[model samples]
Target: MSLPDPPAPIVHPAEYAFGDQVASAEEHLVGQVDQLLRTRFGKPVEAHLAAPTATDFAALRRWYGERAKGWQPLPDVEGAAKAGRGQGFGFSHGDQAFVMVWLTRDAAEGANPVTILRYGKAG
Candidate 1:
């Protein structure tokens, strides 16, 4: 059977933090994350599947815990999951910041998804 068409790209409004700015600001952040992934990993990421469950977050925390200390979960923002797609990927930018993204499950399995992006101090 043919696969369903992927959902249209949705950047959850609540998660985006550009106050009174145009949508392009959020788009720009996504673009920066994309660029960082491509340059650092030497490949393109296609989607970021959502992980909205405690189990999902726990697994992610475990993984991060392996690499560093003081790892903390980002708060769940409205619409961040985007149809229940979960947070799937993350990286650190030097010693200053950590970035995470959520992806659709299909995208997580088949490709890359940079759906939800959040960054905070690296610890």
Candidate 2:
């Protein structure tokens, strides 16, 4: 699904687990998230298939997560699991997207999990 030129705010910050992606509870708007618009879909939401493949993850990291405009990080920021870092791919269903992500059961209080995509060295 295509997001707005400036993606709408965390209207629904609640994410659920599927295989395609991971999310953190503490959500914040990372710079450049607006630039990255389109990400490939592994299977349609209707299919309810397994998560993305390793190859897909690599591409997303290289493109959606690190290289391209990069991942926006979440379905619902408020609902994410607490504190830590993880990675994954984008899985879009209509207006919603559930990305691939690695998750640890728990983390430090207020730590707030989030994904860190690649960035160019500051000039």
Candidate 3:
């Protein structure tokens, strides 16, 4: 007997939206993300001049987390918005997770863009 085919990927709407935004925002966004996005995801990334709104950033973060190979919990934010600070998810692309990072329109500034994030491989 013949074997069955593999299942298709579950591409969520939010994931697609984020990809579109990233693509529209930059031509080599993937390269840029691969270079620096890693640092922002799990740390307090510095704010930029043209950073996106906190909500948008959080949305994108969630999307990233969904595809994460591994995720970790973080402390709760004492004052700032829940999305802005506190625990975050982590994932590994290959051998290393690098440094999960995210940038807003105002990331150039000294604003804390990074959060309590974690990354690794899932069992």
Candidate 4:
């Protein structure tokens, strides 16, 4: 199945530390997700791909009745070079998803720890 081109790379501010080391984090993420889909489901006739956002994480926490304790995306990446500038991804097929989350809050290098969660379509 064919998919629309991924969204344009996020134009980060000068202060955002998505440097050369992790410059292609977004592309890497899309590639990772695509690889997973191809390996497991061979791509779907109808698929949805979305870049994760700060609001998305916050909503997840809120949806689960969790309270935030002074957490924020660091303006400069510090821990790991990741697509943590709310630039990771999520792919959904039907009612299920293979979602990616940044473990390190706002990586100092515009990249952070990545966690992928699979739901609904386990098989």
Clashes of 3: 37
Q: Is candidate 2 or candidate 4 better by TM-score?
A: 4
| All-Cα superposition RMSD per candidate | 13.2, 14.3, 12.7, 11.6
lDDT of each: 0.38, 0.30, 0.32, 0.37
Candidate 3: RMSD over Cα atoms? 12.7
How well does candidate 2 score on lDDT at residue 51?
Answer: 30
Instruction: Judge candidate 2 at residue 115 and give its lDDT.
Output: 35
Report lDDT (Cα) of residue 106, candidate 4. Answer: 45
Clashing pairs in 4: 76-108, 77-107, 77-108, 77-109, 78-107, 78-108, 81-111, 82-111, 82-112
Model 4: per-residue lDDT, tens digit, 1-123?
111232323122334343454435544544544454555445423222332333344454343222212222222222222433333344444444444434333433343333344534431
lDDT: the better of candidates 1 and 2: 1
lDDT of 3 at 13: 23
- After TM-score superposition, the amount by which residue 100's alpha carbon in candidate 1 deviates from its true location, in angstroms, is 1.6
Model 2: per-residue Cα lDDT over 67-88, one tens digit each: 2233354443223322223333
Report the lDDT tens digits of candidate 3 across residue range 10-123.
111222233454444432322334334344343322211222343354564556555543433222221122233222233444433422333344443323223222223311
TM-score of 3: 0.26
- Best by lDDT, which number? 1
Off by over 4 Å in 1: 1-60, 77-95, 105-109, 114-123
- Candidate order by decreasing TM-score: 1, 4, 3, 2
- Cα deviation of 116, candidate 4, in Å: 13
Give the TM-scores of the predictions, in the order they appear. 0.30, 0.21, 0.26, 0.28
Q: What is the Cα-based lDDT of residue 116 in candidate 4?
A: 41
